[model samples]
Target: MKHAALTGISPAVIAELKNGRARTLELTSAHNIITLTEAAPGECIFVTSVNEEDLSPGDPGIMVDLLALNIGMRRIEVANSFFYEERERMSARIKVQFRGITLTRDVEGRKWGDPTKVEIVRSACYRAG
Candidate 1:
């Protein structure tokens, strides 16, 4: 199967994500909520979000290159879908990254309603090494 291009992602994180070893990455900011459910090195980074009320017609949700994501304090760049007018005027995308990650405590203790407890604070994208 053809896969999406991923940049700046660490090999270890890709392995973990592909092998089902890593927890889901959930990030929240003042205006948006992002969830990375699945990912692979060359595959598309499956994602969903809330609070992004503005979407163009036939929008297929958010999809990004898994490798494009910089791991270990690296930033992820995404086009702004919430504000089309601003995006057109600026011709720029938003740069965001994760910080202060907290994984789920225990499998048994995880609630059915809320299985994962991963928490990532959203911050400005850092320079990728």
Candidate 2:
């Protein structure tokens, strides 16, 4: 039997989660960092507290949606997203429709004047369900 596709969560974390061990998943954004702890007894996922690093002092931070990752026999789903702040804060959710190979380049801490020029590289092919 084929195993579920692994995305954001690492192999070690998955193993621990399956074995009733506690673990934390850290996710960082442009200006803030969030940590996801274990879910409740029946729940399989947890969400992190909202971070407001990108917001100015006294300004309310944009509320991000709850993220979920499902590992199943037929498909895997990872709710990943990125947030950008301009005059108005906007969020871009990264979604994949099918199981396929993906390539990513990490440019953390790279300084660039133009944010729009930056891009995320993704390539995928969908299989019939």
Candidate 3:
């Protein structure tokens, strides 16, 4: 039984979207943070979001896109994303296809930054889809 999963952020680079600097970590037994200039075309990657309900109760997987991540980062203007309580149960899986290699990450505490309050909550990443 595979309880742990790996996700990829396959798509255009989100560094600009994030507004903050985002470094892609090399996929190895020991996670290493690396920089991603851009994602090549025709590459396939997956971003999986899981909730507490799915963790213990078990349920379907949540689908998310890389554009959302970039948007959220852009909206917040920071690379460090924190999810709201509602989203606390939810986790994000980013699968990015850089060059010929595919990279992924399990991001937690992701949320949208409120321009007014500055307290970022509700991620726009999953808003579109």
Ranking of all predicted structures according to lDDT, beginning with the best and ending with the worst: 1, 2, 3
Clashing pairs in 1: 6-67, 6-68, 7-67, 7-68
Which predicted model would earn the best lDDT?
1
Report the Cα lDDT for residue 96, model 1: 29
- Candidate 3: misplaced stretches above 4 Å? 1-5, 8-23, 28-41, 49-129
**Ranking 1 against 3 by lDDT, winner:** 1
Q: Candidate 2 at residue 76, lDDT?
A: 33
Could you tell me the lDDT of residue 35 within candidate 2? 18
**Candidate 3 structure quality by residue, lDDT tens digits, 1-129:** 111222232233333323333233223211111111222223222222332112222222322122211111112233436643322122222343211211222232123221100111232443221
User: TM-scores across all candidates?
Assistant: 0.20, 0.20, 0.17
For candidate 2, give the lDDT of residue 31.
28
- Compose the digit string of candidate 1's lDDT tens values, residues 1-129: 221111223445434443333244423331221122222344433222211232222322223333433223324455566743321111112232221112111111122222121222232443232
Candidate 1 lDDT for residue 18 = 38
* Higher-lDDT candidate of 1 and 2: 1
Please give the distance, in angstroms, between residue 79's alpha carbon in candidate 3 and its true position after superposition. 36
Taking the tens digit of each residue's C-alpha lDDT, what string does model 2 give over 44-73?
221112122221122211111223422212
Q: lDDT per prediction?
A: 0.28, 0.25, 0.24
State in Å the error of residue 27, model 1: 6.6
